[model samples]
Target chain A: MSELTGLTLKAALEGLAAKRFSSEEITTAHLAAIDASSALNAYVVGTPEKALEMARASDARRASGQAGPLDGAPLGIKDLFCTEGVESTAGSMILRGFKPAYESTVTSQLWRDGAVMLGKLNMDEFAMGSSNETSAWGPVVNPWRQQGRNADLTPGGSSGGSAAAVAAELCLAATATDTGGSIRQPAAFTGTVGIKPTYGRCSRWGIVAFASSLDQAGPMARSVEDTAILLRSMAGHDPKDSTSIDAEVPDFASFCGRSVKGLRVGIPREYRVDGMPAEIDALWEQGIAWLKDAGCEIVDVTLPHTKYALPAYYIIAPAEASSNLARYDGMRYGLRVEGDNLTDTYEKSRAQGFGAEVKRRILIGTYVLSAGYYDAYYLKALKVRRRIADNFDQAWQTCDALLTPTAPSAAFALGDKSDDPLAMYLNDIFTVTVNLAGLPGMSVPAGLDAQGLPLGLQLIGRNLDEGTLFSLGSALEKAADFRARPAKWW
Target chain B: MAIDAATVRKVAKLARIAEPESRIEPLANELNGIISWIEQLNEVDTDGVEPMTTSVAMGLPMRDDVVTDGGDPAKVLGNAPRAEKSFFVVPKVVE
Candidate 1:
């Protein structure tokens, strides 16, 4: 691995500003690293020429004293974002060969700050699955494997490629979207840092829609500071997306290293779900202790609606997804299958285009939103969602933030739970409520599990209070002091 | 409610996705499993609770009725599977 590829995003920025090496050199080094790490399947497309061109421009800008915050830094984009002139498949055959004519607002912002694109990363088909197995491109193998084991484990999805790429040092950081733990769960699995900012914190204009209400783009990196740095560039109000929050973007990096003293951190007792691993419990205790040591007031709180979040999330997400995906008929872009008639063409194209999981979600979505079942399923789930958010609202009155295990367990083998959709859905048990409540949540690598894979603790903050999460996250990052990297096997 | 094969076919048609007879049973079973799991929501009392349509509780921001962008037909049709001149070509509907 090249030394340049190993540097954190902040370190790379400093190096570029110091002129220790040109952006071209670092970008080239990362491109080579990406080439050597193809077995990981982290990136779906590798844009070496485009990366070098952007890097060269960044270097020239630096020489002219016009460098941006992320000038010359290379990052991976989750294929969910529509990159102009680059095929954005959302890891499904339905969108095969479809490239957007315009760039997503988030990626365009990164480019404006002089960030170089390494190419699109893979994800679950339309961000629908808990594991990357749903991806038509293939599953992303986690860089970390169990000690003395030969079997490859899954980097959690649907941002598995982004997490794997950052964990493997293929990019300084990667852009990811979290609709029901796609970002935070994958980050926890790979020992990287990922944040799902409050809903509407980032624009969803050019990203492929899954569950529009739950989907929010965020950053994934090796450290919380780097994640914060990347997020500052990625977030802002955009008129294009009406849901985009009309708020001032904060200097998130500055929130790091701030004192956590006297802040109240809530521990929700309802998260003590059945069958939680012993190591996860111990890690949560350790995290609470660390916060206590940092002078935080640890309060035990209750979110009674926690148990209903997963089921409600499943109904609401897929219901919205079914409606959002109605645009992918035979006439427009993407894979089209012709038939005897227009309606036949529509049916045939969709049946042939979407993968099994995508088809399943669409089916479940359709069923829930069907004529007779609408009130029983979709409407009931929405009411449950409201209660879940109300639970968070009540908890906020007592605590400044909340902490929990990011996932129930550490990374498992690729095929471990893919056969059971319910089993896969349970993986988001600890992380989904944050999305339901539209709060900012982050995963910080806290410790390793019994099998030596990394475990993360989640920190969730109030709406538009990412700065507080960053502060607490940095403090936890310091206390955990997790510097372990996966042994190179790929 | 358990989703029957007939209902599965009906919903698949509603969703505009073709489902052959061979796959209908398995699809019904899978959908039934998921639907049953989510049916647990009925256990909660929500008589007076309003269904939350969005995470953020705000009205849709309205703008003046005017064209702000989008005039290039070529760009709009750039990714169309089948296009002629400036329009997407679909299977014959009005013929």
Candidate 2:
């Protein structure tokens, strides 16, 4: 790998500004790294030609002293975001060969800030699975493996490709989406930093929707500062998405070095679930001690509805997914299979288009929303959703932010939990409550597990209060000082 | 809320997915497992809680009833599976 590929997003920006390296050099290096690392299956499509063109333009702009904040930075976009004229498949066969005509609001913002797109990263089909095994292209392989084991492990999903690419130094950073732990869990699995901003912090226009009410876009990078820098460029209000909050985007980079003194961090008791690994518990204790040593107060807070979050999410997300996916019928765009009648055509197209997991979710969704079951399943889940949010709302009175584990365990081998849907859903137990409550949550790489894989600590902040999480995240990053990188096997 | 093969077939028809006769029983069993797992939500006491349709409490934003930026038919039909001129081609509905 080229040394330029190893530079952090922050370092790359400084290098571009200082004239130490031209934007073309950095872009070429990352493109080459991506080409060499194809075995990892991180990128679904590689845009080397477009990247070079963008790099040249960024260099010229820098020569004229008009460089944007992310000028010359090479980044990977998740396939979930629709890139204008690029084949944006949300990692499903249904959207195979469909090239979107318009750009997503999030990717357009990154380009406007002068970032170069290396390619579209892989993900779970429509951001549904906890592991990337659900992707049509293929599951992404984690760069890290156990000490003596050669079995391939998942990088986590639905942002698995983003996590793998960043961990393998294929890109400086990658854009990821989190409907429910999609961003944070993958980041934890890959030893990267990911933040799912408070609901509507970033516009959802043009991004593929999994669950409209729960979906949000965020960034994944190697460090807290890099994530903050990318997030500042990615977040803002857009009139196109009605759910977007018309709030001012803060300068997130400035909060990276801010003090955490006098801050009250909450430790939610419900996260300590049965059968959790010992290393995860120890890491949580270590995180608490780290915060306490940094002059912050730690308090035990209770989120009574946390246990019900997973069940509620499974209900609400699939219900919304069934509705959102209804647009993929064979007529307008994408794969089409003709049948004897229009309804048969719809059935054949969908049957051939979706994977098993997606089909299952759609079936569950249709069942729940069916006339006789709507009130019993869908409405009841909504009520539980309200209680989950209320628990978090009440916690804010006692603490500035809540701390917990990012996932139940470290990244497991591919196909380990694919057989059992409920076992797979349990992967998001610690992270889903934050999404249900519509708060900003982040995962910072904290320590390594007994098997030598990475473990992360999560911080849940109040709505529209991502600044506090950034401060606390950087503090934890400093204390953890986790510098281990996966050996180059790809 | 145990989903049986009959209910699974009903849902597959409603969802418009071509599930084979052989897959129905297995699909029903899998869905039943998930449904049983989610049935745990009924244990919670939600007496007067309002169903949350959205996370943020904001009214839907409306715009003036005027055309804004979509007129060309070629661009709209660019990705269509089958299109002639400005119209999408589908199987004949009226026979």
What is the CAPRI rating of model 1's predicted complex? high
Candidate 1 RMSD to the real structure:
0.9
* TM-score for the A-chain in each candidate structure: 0.99, 0.99
Interface RMSDs of the predictions, in order, are 0.9, 0.6
Looking at model 1 chain B, report the run of 10 residues with the lowest lDDT sum: B51-60
DockQ of each: 0.87, 0.93
Candidate 1 segments exceeding 4 Å error: none
lDDT of 1 at A361: 94
Q: Write down the lDDT that model 1 would get.
A: 0.94
> Which tens-of-lDDT digit does each residue in A1-490 have in candidate 2?
8889999999999999999999999999998889889789999999999999999999999999999999999999999999999999999999998899899999999999999999999999999998899999999999999888898999999999999999999999999999989999999999999999999999999999999999999999999999999999999999999999999999998999799999999999999999999999999999999999988999999999999999999999999999999999999998899999999999999999999999999999999999989999999999999999999889989999999999999999999999999999999998898888899999999999889999999999999999999999999999999999999988
Cα error of candidate 2 at position A193, Å: 0.2
Top of the candidates by DockQ: 2
- For model 1 the local lDDT of residue A197 reads 97
Tell me how far the alpha carbon of residue A230 in candidate 2 is from the true structure, in angstroms, after superposition.
0.7
lDDT of 1 by residue, A1-490 (tens): 8899999999999999999999999999999999999899999988899999999999999999999989999999999999999989999898988879999999999999999999999999999887799999999999999988988899999999999999999999999999999999999999999999999999999999999989999999999999999999999999899899999999999999999999999999999989999999999999999999999999989999899999999999999999999988968798889999999999999999998898899999998899888998999999999999999999999999999999998999989999889999999999999988899999999999888999999999999999999999999999999999998888
